[model samples]
Target: MLTTNDLMTIDPETVTADVPLREVVAVMNRANIRQVLVVDGKKLVGIVTDRDVRLAVNSPLTTEEPLQRLELLNGFKAKDCMTSNPRCVTPETPIHKVAELLSMYKFGALPVVKDDALVGIITVTDLLNQMALIPEPKS
Candidate 1:
C-alpha cells in the first residue's frame, strides 16, 4: 500500500509567520508551487496556500486605486493569512487517509511531521499522481 512517506515532498518551501505576504508568494512562484509551510525553527506552525494569498486580498484592484491596492497588500502578513495549527499527517499515514482528511477539511495539503519537526508535505496532486502510478488490474 502506498503511504505518505512514499509520496510526500521532502523539505518543502517554508516561511515564517512574520514574513511579508508578497515574499511568500515569490517563494511559491519560484518553486512553481501553490502552497508553503509556515514554520518557526523547524516546527510546523501553519500551512499557507495560493488560496490564502488570494483570500488576503479582500478588495478588487482598480486602475483608479493603485495606492489603495498596494496599501492593502503591504498590510497583509503570513501570520494574518495562514491557517494556524492545521491538522497534520505522519509519514506512516496512508495516502487514502490523507485524501480523506484533505477532502473533509478542504485543505490543499497536509504537513508531514515527525518528532515534532516539519518533515514533508502531502498534496492532493501527490495522491492523484500516486493513484495514476498503480498498474491496471488484469481483466
Candidate 2:
C-alpha cells in the first residue's frame, strides 16, 4: 500500500501562529511551496496556503496604497489568516484516501501527524508525482 509514509515530505516547513504573514510568504517563496503547516512546538495547529495569503491581501473591501498594503501584510500574523485545526492524516494513511480528502475539501495539502506531533506533509503535487511513477499494465 502506497501510504503517506511513501511520499510525505519529512519535517516540512512550519510556522508559529504569531509569525507575520510577510515572513510566511517569504518562507513559501523560498521553499517554492504552496502550503505551510502552522505548529506549536510539534503540535499541528493550523495551515497557511498561497490561496490564503492571496485572499487576505487581495480583499475587495480594502484598497490601500502600496506602502499601506505592505504595512498591512506585516501586521497580519499566521493566525489571522490560517485555517485553524485543519484536517490531518497519519503516516499509515493510504495515498488514495489522502487524494480523496484533498479533492473533496479543495485542500492543497494535508499535515501528517503521529502521536499528536507534526511529522510531515502531503500535497496534491506529491500524489501527482507518485501517479506519474506508476507503470501502465499491459492489456
Candidate 3:
C-alpha cells in the first residue's frame, strides 16, 4: 500500500501569518496551488486556501462594506483568513486513509507531519494519480 510519503509534495509553499492577503493570492497563483500552509517558525499553525479568500471577500457582511473594511476588521493577514488547527496526517499514514479523510471531510488536501514537523502535503490530485496506477480488482 502507498504511504503519504510516496505521493505527498514535500517542502510545499508556505506563508507566514503576517503575509498580506494580496501576497498570499500572488503566491498561490505563482505556485499553481489552491492552498498554502501558514507557519510560524517551524510550527504549522494554519492553512489558507483560495476558497477562504473568496469567502472572506464575498461574505454577505462584506457585500456592502468597503474592501478596506477587511484590513480593519479582518487584519488583512494570512492568520486572519487561514483555518487554524487544521486536520493533519503523518507520513506513515496509508494513502487510502487519507483518501477517506478527504472524502469524509470534503477537504482538498492535508498536511503531512512527522514529529510535529511539517513535511509534505497530499491533495486530491495526488490520490487520483495514485488511483490511476492501481489495477482494478476482478468483479
Q: Considering every candidate listed, which one attains the maximal lDDT? A: 2
Kindly indicate the candidate among 1 and 2 with the higher TM-score.
2
Q: Which tens-of-lDDT digit does each residue in 57-125 have in candidate 3?
A: 776666565666455334578898899979999999998899999999999999988888889899999
For residues 1-139, could you state the per-residue lDDT of candidate 1 as single tens digits? 8799999999999999998888888899999999999999999999888998877665454344657656656788889889999899999998889999999998889999999999999998998887788899999
Winning candidate number (TM-score): 2
Q: Against the unseen true structure, what C-alpha lDDT does each candidate score?
A: 0.88, 0.94, 0.88
Alpha-carbon error at 34 in model 1, in Å?
A: 1.3
Candidate 2 residues lying further than 4 Å off, grouped into runs, are 137-139
The lDDT of model 2 is: 0.94
**Whole-structure CA lDDT of model 1:** 0.88
Off by over 4 Å in 3: 63-75, 135-139
For residues 1-139, what per-residue lDDT tens digits would candidate 2 score against the true structure? 8899999999999999999999999999999999989999999999999999999888886676777678878989999999999999999999899999999998889999999999999999999998898899989
Residue pairs with clashing backbones, model 2: none
TM-scores across all candidates?
0.89, 0.95, 0.87
